[model samples]
Target: MSVMELLASRRTYRRFEQKAVPQDVVEDIIEALRLSSCGANRQAVRLVVVNRPEDVARVQPLVKWAAYLPPEQGTPKADELPTLYVAVMQDTSIPGDLATDTGIALANMTLAAWAKGVGSCIMGAINKPALTRLLGIEEPQKLAFMVAFGYPAHKAGIVPLTEQTGVKYYLDEHRDYCVPKRSREEIARYL
Candidate 1:
């Protein structure tokens, strides 16, 4: 698929099939992170790959799911959990834009995953302290985000934003994700 097509189809995926992601795909995701550009090339971002089923299960509860919808509709069932989790962290000892670096790395990783037919969700609303402890993250390293990945079980797509639709993403009647996006004309201006 073309890059634009890939970008358009790479929506945030919450519900996933229980099938495991291939090891090569997981490695590619990590490699994407490793090669992602960072401010000043500090490359302060660190990662912890939770590909083992048991370890993935341990990390699941510590990370929250979609916030726009109620838990019943947004959270995945036990059988629908992601097969992999990659914890994004920042090395405190290396000073840089943590947020920007993490964002770049995540975009690269997720895009790479999607290109390989894997779905992903970048999670932020999580039990950070507990996760840090559970993942054995130490000083000089701080957990920033968790990315869940697997084969998607549901579909998600962009919907035009209307007066009634506001901006929050919602589950359609079919339970597929409907993310409302403002038109380019509404958000951009030509110089």
Candidate 2:
């Protein structure tokens, strides 16, 4: 698929099938993160892969799901949880903008996973202290975020925002996601 197509289809996936992403795909996702561009190439970002089922279960509760919808509508059930989690970290000892680097790494990793038919949710609303302890993250390494991954159980698609629709994403009658997006005319302009 074309890059634009990939970007359009790569929506945030919350509910996932109860299956592990292939080991090879996981490796590619990590490699994508490794190769992502960072501010001034400081490369302060790090990762902790949690592919083991037991570890994934332990990490699940520490991270929050979609905030736009109610818990029952947004949060994935036990059987719908992602089979893998990758903890994105920042090496505070290194000097650089952690937020920029983290965003680049997340984009690369999530796109790679999506290309291989694996879905991902980039989670930032989390219990940071507990996750740091659980993942054994030491000084100089701070938890930036966690991304959940697996084959998607539900479909999500972008919809152009209308007067009736707001910016917030919502679930359709089928529980699938409808992510409303602003039109280019509204959000961009020629100088």
Every candidate's lDDT: 0.94, 0.93
lDDT of 1 by residue, 76-115 (tens): 9998999999999999999878899999999999999999
Per-residue lDDT tens digits of candidate 2, residues 19-44? 87999998998899889998888899
Each prediction's number of clashing residue pairs: 0, 0
Runs off by more than 4 Å, candidate 2: none
* TM-score for predicted model 1 compared with the true structure: 0.98
Q: Each model's TM-score, in the order given?
A: 0.98, 0.97
In candidate 1, list every pair of residues with a backbone clash.
Answer: none
Candidate 1 structure lDDT: 0.94
Indicate the residue-level lDDT of 68 in model 2. 90
